[model samples]
Target chain A: MKAVTYQGKKKVEVKEVGDAKLIKRDDMLVRVTSTAICGSDLHIYHGLIPGMYDDYVIGHEPMGIVEETGPDVTRVKKGDRVIIPFNVACGECFFCTNQMESQCDNANDAKDTGGYFGYSETYGGYMGGQAELLRVPFGNFVPFKVPEDAEVEDEKILFLSDILPTAYWGVDNAGVKPGDTVIILGCGPVGLLTQ
Target chain B: MDYRLEHAKRTNHVETYNFEKTHDIDQTLLEATKGGADVVIDCVGLDAKRTAMEKVETALMLQGGSLGAFNTAANVVRKFGTIQVIGVYGLKYNMFPFGHLFERNVQVKMGQAPVIHYMPELFRQIQTGKIDPTDIITHRLHISDAPRAYEIFDNKDESCIKVVLKP
Candidate 1:
């Protein structure tokens, strides 16, 4: 399979990598149809993210079709088009129970600091979706079904994997009122989304 | 309104503070607001050139009125006006004119934006045509050209607001 790998600072390459498959009962294999490069990925590209290793698959935002799923995965099935959340979390953890699945205790325990796919060392070192296929863990918790009549494009839906949620979070965090004037610092994707 | 100059231009009420050719930030702001602005939001986040912590210290050293975002916010705002700081600064810092805040009764708000909580609402806004996130995407390139996209975005190339790479 081919995947975009981060080599070092300001470096990335599309290279051949081993195939991915279902690794857990709750895991699902997705044949990636669309993927996006996120600003967070630039942190790795610029080597600002410490502990970044070589051959790291680089991407998190993706919308794809389920190629296969483990027996325990029930939220989506083969042939279902879906959007993959950036994070891979166990639904049974305290954070997951509270709807803060991004900080799931069980998933965090598995990695140094758990995060979604394609993040650097600070987050969990899960491979990302800028590849031919992706192995999505806890598929039931992360894969969202695409609306039947939705006219949203893959690029737009792909943003739901991280930036869209992040931008929305920023506006909410700022407590922006209906008529309040909000000024975002960075005009990057996340910042622009706030506008 | 550094990177937001273009977007702010779309809004009739938005006044920009360009530091590139102007040294009189206070005066520039005053002219923009026509005496003073009701609210001042700092998006520069401790950027040395824009934040100018040293300049603020110099003003304090000379016993000058408040300067920089904090002091400017205090001075240029109407009494009891609001100052929302979206910029990042040193946690263990000092040298701010804390007394003026009380004198003017200014309100200061600052913090990191928690982006997850607002996803549902933002999504609805996009769906409803209230805002177009795509407008910010000034550059679109192939996934193979991702390196160039970063170069343009980082360097702030002309009219390059956001770069989207198709993979």
Candidate 2:
């Protein structure tokens, strides 16, 4: 499969890498239809993120038709349309149950934080979804099924994978009220959305 | 920057400021909010524009990326106000305003967004048309065009805000 691979500072290439397959019992393979380049991906592109080597697959926001699912994956099926959230969570961990999936215990071993798709080894060594195919682990929880009946364009909901929820969480976490004056610092995607 | 500021003003109907143009940004924000803003969200994280000293420090690994946005957040937030950081900040910084925050009873909340926890509600909002996120997408290219996509996005070419790739 062809994937966006990180070469070094300000360099990337779409190379033919090995196909992503179902490895874990809870894993699923997704035939990516849509993917996005995140602002944080720039950190990797600029060589600021450690534990990244050449040709590391580098995308996190992706959604598509599920090509296959492991036997244990009962939440989604082969033909289901789904969006893979950037966080790679087991869904059964203490953090996942407590609404802290980003800090899931089972995702990343390199750091104390949770696992992230396509991020450097600091988050987890999981391959990114920039490729034609993505191997998504923790399939029971990681993949959010796009409502089959919605009939909305992918652009409308693709940000659920990251920035939309991120902006919402920023506002929600800060307890911004109806009359409260909220000042967002940046005009980036997340900042714009937060405003 | 003008394009984004204009977009924010026109679409969201919110006041926007360019830090580079404003001589005293914190003072301006404080006056605009009539004391200080109740909430200051830091969407620009470590990679924000740095001062000459910060540029040198960051180059030497003596500090994290620029604390410019964080400093502005600190300065523009009212006493006992909240500052939420949605942007990514890694490593340690030299001048982390602990004393000021502690004295003012300010609250700081940060870290990665646990996206799964909020996905359902956001999805519902999108489905209901309460918000439309598609306007942020300025480019749509094939997955094979990723190299050029990265260049344009990194360089902020053609007013590129977001880029989506179709595989």
lDDT of each: 0.64, 0.92
Lowest lDDT block of 10, candidate 2 chain B: B2-11
What would the per-residue lDDT of candidate 2 be over residues A1-195, giving only the tens digit for each residue?
999999988899999999999998999999999999999999899888889999899999999999999999999998899999999999998999999999999999998989999998888899998999999999899999987788988899999999999998899999998899989999988888988
- Which number leads on lDDT? 2
Per-model DockQ against the true two-chain complex: 0.23, 0.90
Candidate 1 lDDT by residue in tens digits, B62-129: 32222344555556665666666654443333557688777878777665333233345555666777
TM-score (C-alpha, index-matched) for candidate 1: 0.72
Alpha-carbon error at B64 in model 2, in Å?
1.4
- Model 2 / residue B68 / CA error / Å: 0.5
Per-residue alpha-carbon lDDT of model 2 for B109-150, expressed as tens digits? 998999997988889999999999999899999999999999
Stretches of candidate 1 exceeding 4 Å from the true structure: A110-114, A179-181, B1-4, B11-13, B19-124
Candidate 2 interface RMSD (Å): 0.7
